[model samples]
Target: MHQYVFSGLRVSSEFKFTIADCEPFDGSPDVTIRFVQYLEKPLHPIFADEIVTAAPNDVWFCASGDLAYRVKDGSEILIQRGENVPDADVNLYLVGTGFGVLCLQRDLIPFHCSAVEYNGHAVAFSGESGVGKSTLAAALSQLGYGHVCDDVCIANSAQTPMRVQPMPKGLKLWDDAAAQLNIAQGARVSADLDFHKSYVNVDRADQTGGLMFNRIYILDNDIAPEFSIHELKGAEKHAELRRAIYREEWLHFLQEPRKTFDLVSTLASKVAVFAFKRPDDLSRIKESAKFLALHFDDGDAE
Candidate 1:
C-alpha cells in the first residue's frame, strides 16, 4: 500500500482504484473528468447509478441502492472507467476526486496558476484560462524549471511567508499547445471531454533548485507587446488578488468571507505583480521564456 500526502491530508492505498477499467457514466457532468477512481472502495457505493437531471447547477448523482452520492456544488467532478486509485492515509472516496477538492477546502487560499521553483521560493504564473498560464509553465519546464502545480495551487497565507502545496503532477494543455511542447500523442491524462492534460515530474527536467517568487507576471493579451513590473497598492491590488484566487465556488463555504479576503489581500501585498504581453509569433516563445528567467534572476539578486 502506498500513501500520498498533500497540503495536510494523507491518502492511503486502501482507497486506490483504476479508471480505465471502471464503468463510464452515460450522463457525465459539465466538467468532463475520466479518471474517477476511489481510494478505498467506499464502505458502500459512493455514486448514484441513475442520472438525476435537473437544472444544470442542481444536477446530482447517486449510486443505485446506495446512500453515497455526488452533488454538484460549482466544483468539478469526474468518474472514469478502470482508473487506478493510489494508497493513502485518508479513506474518503472523493479525497482524490480531482484538484477541486483541495482547492475548495476552507483552510487554503488556492490560486489558478502554474507554480515552479526558481531559486528557493515558488514562482506562480496566474491569469485567465486561455491566457497562456500553462503554456508559459511548460516553456519554463523545457528551460529546466521544476513544476509544483498546474491549474489548482493551494496555499496557506496565515504564516509570515505564505506556503503552497503541490496539486497533481499533471499539466493541462490545449491540443495545439501540446504539439508545441512536443509531448507524445499518447502521454496525456484526460481532465474533461474537450481538454487533454499531461503530467511530468519537475526533477525529470535538467533544472534543479526551488524558486522563491520575487515577481509575478499577469498575462495580458489586450496589451501591446510590452512589460511592466511595478508595485501594486490600494484597492486595485486587492481586486487583482481576488480575481487571481482560484476555486471561487468554495468561497461561500467559508464561515467568514472577509477573513479569507483579508488573508489573501495580505499575501498578494507581499508579492510583486507584473503585466506581460503574449508574443504575436510562435517563434518568440523562447524569447518570452528568456525574458521571464532574466527578470526573476535579476530581481532576486537585488
Candidate 2:
C-alpha cells in the first residue's frame, strides 16, 4: 500500500504504477488517491477523448482506463483515474480549469494571480499568457524578492485579515526565458507544454512567511512603455478582475457561468488592482517590480 498526503489530507492504497503512467506530485492532504473500478462517460467536445467527468463529487480525475479513489472530508470519494499525490502544508485546491475555486467553503476570497513576497507583503502579478507574468516574477526573485507562487496563488480573505497560500515551488517559463534563467537542457516544462515551457525555482534564496498582497499589476500589451499604477474601483474594476481570474485545467465542472462569475466577483473586491504594460524593451519587467516596491513604501509613510 502506498500513502500520499496533500494539504494534510492522506490517501493510502495498495497499487503499483509504471514510470510512463505517473503524474507530477502535488503535496496536499485534501486528496488521497487509489485505483478502483473502470467507468466511462461522454467526452467533452473540446477536451475530446483525453478527459472525462464523473458524477456525485464532480471531481474530474484523469482518464486512463484505471480506477482511483480520492479521500477527503473523512469520506472516500473515488477518483476514476489519476496520479500519486503528496502531503501539502497549505490546503487550497484549484477546482476547475481556467478558473479559481477553493476546496474549502470558508469565507475567504481567492484571487487568480502569480504572487510573491517582497519586504514581508504578498505582491500578486495577475495577467494573461505571453504577458511576461513568470518573467516579471523571476526578475523580482533574482533581485531579492521571495516567491510564493508563479502561476496560481490562493488567499484566505474570510479571516479577520487576508492571507496568501504558498504555491508549489517553481515558475513555468518560455524557452527563451528558460535559456535566460539557465535551466538544465531538455528538462520537461509543465505537464501541458508542447513546445516552449520550463520550470524555475527561486526558493534557494529565502523561503518564509506568506506575504499579504499589498499591490496588483494587471499586464496588458496596449499600455505605454513606462510603468504606472492605478487603483481599481467600482464595477469596471470588478469586471476586469473577473476576466483575469485564473482558470483550473479541469474546467468541465464549471460549465455553469453563474458559478464562475459569482466566485470571481467576490475575489476582486478584496485586493487592489493595477494595469501594467511594456514596450518592445523587456527591462520594464524589472522596473515594474521596483516601481511597486517603492510606491507601496511611499504609501506606508503617509
Candidate 3:
C-alpha cells in the first residue's frame, strides 16, 4: 500500500503517486483510498450526471474514458481504474479534483487557487479558468517562493491566519503557458488523454501541518487596458471567498449556507483579499507576476 499525508489529512492509498511531497503518516490515516475493479451505482438517485453526482453523504465523479471515483462520508475514496488510462492518469484526477471534493464534504474551505509560501506566509492567486492561477504560482516558484499548493487550495479557516495545506502536486500547466514562461520545468504528466492538461514538478517545501495564509488575489478577467488592484471589504470579500470555492456546485448539497457564510466572514476578518484586474494581453502575464513580486517584497507589504 502507498501512503502520504496530504492537505492535513493522513491518506493511505493503494497506488503510487507522483506528487511533489509525500511522506508516510506515523498515525493511521484519516482517509483511505482503495483501488477496486468496479463500483456499483449509488442506491439513491444521483444529484447530477455527466460530471459529478453528489448526495448528502456521498459524491461520485467520472472521467470520460479513464476512471470512476466515489467519495464516501468525507473520509474514504473508491477509485475504479479503467483499462484506457495509465496509472499516472488515474492518480492525476484522484489527487487533484477527487481530493478537493473530499475537503468540501468535510466542511473544510477548498478554494480554486494556487498558493505559494513566501517570506513567512502564504500568498494565493485565485481566478477564473484559463486565467493563469497556476502560471502565476509557477512564476513565483521559479523566483524562489516555496510552493504551498495548486489548482485546489485547502484551508483550515478556523485558525487565525487560515493555515493553508500543501496539496503538493506541483503546478499543472497547459502547453501555451509552459512555452510562454521559459522555465525549465520537469517532464509533463498527462492529466487526460482527451484533454491536454499537463503537470510540471516543483520540488517539495512543506510544514507538516500548513503555512499561514496572509493574502489572496482574485485575478479578475474583466477586460481592461491596464492592470489594477481593488481591495475588497465586508460583503464583497466574503462573496469572493464564496466564489473561490473549488467546484462550488457541490456546496449547496454538502453544507448549509449559514455555515459557509460564517466560514468566509471569519477568514475575511483575518486575511486580506484583493481583486486584481488583469489586462487582455497575454504577453503581459509576466508583467503581472513582476507586479506581485514587487508589491509583496519585504518593505512593500506594510
Candidate 4:
C-alpha cells in the first residue's frame, strides 16, 4: 500500500500516484483507498447526472470512458479503474472531485483555489474555471514565490486562525501555457486523450506543519491593459467566497447548511477577500505576476 499524508489525513492507497509533495506517513491511515475490479453505483441516489450520482454520505463519480469511483463516509474510496486509462488520469479525478467531497464529509472546507506562500503564510487565488488561477500561481512562482497547493486549498475554519492543510500536487497547466512559459512537463493528465493538460513541477513551500491562511484573491478578467485590485466587503465578499467552494453541486447531498455556513462565515471573516483584475493575454503573465509580487511585498492588502 502507498502511505502518505494528504489534507491533514493519513491516506493509504492501493494505487501509485504521480503527483508529488505528499509526505509519507507510517501510522494507521485515516482514509483507505482500495482498487476494485468492479464496483456498483449508489442504489438510491439523491442526486444523479452524467458526471456523478450521489446519496447521503455516498457519491459515485464517473470519469471519461470506464473510470468510476465510490467515495463513502469520508473515510474510504473504492476505485473501478478503466482498463486502458492511465494512472495519472485516474489520479486527476481522485485528487480533484473525489477528495473534494471527502473533505466535505470530514467537515473540512475545500476552497477551490491555487495558493502560494506569501510572507510566511498562504495567499490563495480563486475564480471560475479558465480564469488562470493555476497559471497565475505558476507565474508568481517564477518570481520566487513558493507554490503551496493547487486546485483545492483544504481549509479548517473551526480553528482560531483558520489553518490550511497543504496538499501540493505540483502545477497542472495546459500545453500552451507550459510551452509559452517554458515549463518542463511532468506527466500527461488527460484520460480521454486530450493531451493538452499535464503536470509541471515547480518550487514549493515547506509542508512540515500547518500554515495559516489569511488572504484570498478572486481573479477577474479586465479589458484594460493593466492590472488592478479591489477589496470586496460585506455580503459581496461572502457571496464570492461561497462560490469558491469546490464541487459545490454536491453540497445538497452533504446537507449541513448550519455547519457549512458557519465555516464559510468564519472564513470570510478571517481572510481578506479582494477582486484582482488583469488582462487576458498570456504573454503578459510575467508583468501581472510582478504586479502581484510587489503587492505581496508591500503588504498593501493587509
Candidate 5:
C-alpha cells in the first residue's frame, strides 16, 4: 500500500499516485482506494443518469474513457478500469471529478481554482475553463510566489477561517504556455499526451498543513489595454464563489442545500473577492504577474 496526503487527507491506495508521497502512518487512512474486478450499483439511487448512479454515500461513476469507479462514504474508492486502461487515465478521474465528489461527502468545499501563496496567504484564481487561471498562477510562481495547487483548491469549511489545503502538485501547462514561460526545456513530465499539457516543477510551498485562504480573484479577459482589479461586494462575492465550485454538477447528488449555502456565505464573508481583468494576450503574462505583485505591495502599504 502507498500512503499519500491529498488536500490534507492521509490516503492509502493500492496503486501509486503522482501526488506527493508520504511515509506510512500507523492509524487507519482518512481515505482508501482499492482495486476491484466489479462493483455493485446502489440499490436505492437518488440520481441516475446514463453515466452516473449516485446515492447519499455510494456513487458509481462511469467515465467516457471506459473507466469506472465506486466511491463510498467519502472514505473509500473502488476502481474498475476498462480493458487495457492505463494508470494515468485512472488517475486523471480519481484526482479531478472523483475527488471533488469526495470533498462534498466529507463536507469540504472544492473550488475549481488555481491557488498560490502570496504575502503569506493563499490567494486563489478562479474563472471559467480557458480563462487562464493556471497560466496566471504559473506566471506568479515565476515571480517567487509559491504554487499551492494548480487545478483544485480544497477548503476546510468546517472551521471559522476556512483553510486551503496544499495539493503539492506540479504546475500543468499547455505546450504553448510552457514555451511562453520558457520552462519547456526543463525536466518535466507529460500531464496528458493527447492534450499536449506537461507538468513542470515550480517553487512549491510548504505542504505539511493548510494555509489560511484569504483572497480570490476571478480572472476575466476584457477589452481593456491595462490590467484592472475590481472588488466584488455582497451578492457579487457570493455568486462568484458559488460559480467556482469544482464539479458542482455532483452537488445535486449530495443534497445539502443549507450546508452548501452556509459554506459559500461564510467564505464570501471571510475572504475578499475581486474581478481581475486584463487583455487576452499571453505575451504580457509576465507583466500581469508584476501588476499583481505591485497590487499586493499596495495592500501591504495600506
Candidate 6:
C-alpha cells in the first residue's frame, strides 16, 4: 500500500506513482485507488451506451484502450487497467482525467489551469490544452514562484485561507521548453508518441496550502495580438469559468447541473477572473511570464 497526499486528500494506491508528492497519512486514507484486471461492465443501464457518464456522486468510464475507471462518491476509485498497461499513460489518465472526475464528484471546483503561488496566493492560468499554460507556469517557477499544481486546480480547499490544492509533478512542458528555460534536467514522461512533452520537477511541493486562491488568468493565443491582461465581469466571468472546467467532457453526464452552477457562481464571486491574450509565438513565453509576475507579485493583478 502506497500513500501520498494528492489534491488535498490522503490517497492510498495499489501501485506506486512516480510523481506523487510525498506526504504522510495517519489511520486510513481519504481516498483509495485499487488496481485490478478485467472490469466487468456496470450491472445497471445508467452508462451502458456511452464512453463516459458522470452522475451526481459517481462517474463511469470505459475508455483509454482497455482501461476502465469507476469513481464512487469521491471515496474510492476502482481502476481496471486491462491491456492499457503503460505506466506513463496510466499515471496520465489517473491524475489528469481520473482525478478531475473525482474532484467533480467530491464537489470541488476543477479549473483547467496551471496554478502557482505568488506571495501567498494562488494565481491560476486557464487556457486550452495547447495555449502554453504549463509552459508559462514552468517559467514562473524559474522566477521563484512556487508551483501549486499543474493541469488541475482544486479550488476552495476545505482547509484555511481558501487555497487550491497541489497535484503531483508540476509543469509538464514540451521538450523544447525544457532546454529553452534551462531548467534542471528531468525524466522524460511524455503522454504522446511525438515525445514533445516532458514533466519537469520545477515546482516540487514543500508543503500544501496556507495561501488563498486569488485570481484566475484566462489565455487565448488567437485573440490577443500582444500579451495583455484584462479583468472579466458579469456574464463573461461566469461563462469563462464554465468554459474552463478541467476534463469538461465528463460534465456532459453530470446529474447536478444546478449544484454545479451554484458552485461556479460562488467561485466567480469569491475571486477575480481575467482574460489574457498573447500572439501564438512560442518564443515569447519568458517575456509573458515576466509580465504576469510584474502584475501578480504585488497582489494587484486584476
lDDT for each residue of candidate 3 in 192-214, tens digit (9 for 90 to 100):
45655676766445566677776
> How does each model score on lDDT?
0.52, 0.51, 0.76, 0.83, 0.80, 0.75
> What lDDT is obtained when candidate 3 is compared to the true structure?
0.76
Candidate 5 local lDDT, 1-302, one digit each (tens): 89977787889998787656666777889999998887777779999988899988889898655578888889998888777777666777788777888877887888899977865678889988888888888999899988889889788866766688855555788778878998753423433456677677788877456888778888975667889987899998888888888977677677577877888898887778888989888899999889977877776511
Query: Per-residue CA lDDT of candidate 6, range 1-302, in tens?
Result: 88888877888998678787467789888899898776554444344455775555676786567677878888888888766467776777788777888887777767898877766677889888888888888888888888877888777634444567767655677777877888665666754577767767775435445347768898875756677777899899988888788876556565457866777777776778888887777678789899888778565743
What TM-score does model 1 achieve against the real structure? 0.65
Candidate 4: regions farther than 4 A off: 21-24, 300-302
Model 5 TM-score relative to the real fold: 0.92
Q: What would the per-residue lDDT of candidate 1 be over residues 15-87, giving only the tens digit for each residue?
A: 3432211223333323322233441232233322243322322223332222222323333333422323222
lDDT of 6 at 300: 76
Candidate 3 clash pair list: none
Give the RMSD in angstroms, all C-alphas superposed, for model 2: 6.9
Model 5, CA-based lDDT = 0.80
| Ten residues in sequence with the least summed lDDT for candidate 4 | 18-27
Residue 8 of model 1 has an lDDT of: 39
lDDT of each residue in 109-207, candidate 2, tens digit only: 345567667666777777766778777777777767677676665565553345565445356677776566554434344343365665555653233
Error of 6 at 53 (Å): 4.2
- The best candidate by TM-score is 4
The superposed Cα distance between candidate 2 and the true structure at residue 14, in angstroms, equals: 8.6
> How many residue pairs clash in each candidate at the backbone level?
44, 30, 0, 0, 0, 0
Alpha-carbon runs more than 4 Å astray in model 6: 43-50, 53-56, 157-161, 203-206, 297-302
- Span of 10 residues, lowest total lDDT, candidate 5: 184-193
Better of 2 and 6 by TM-score: 6
When 3 and 4 are scored with TM-score, the better candidate is 4
Off by over 4 Å in 1: 13-104, 191-215, 249-255
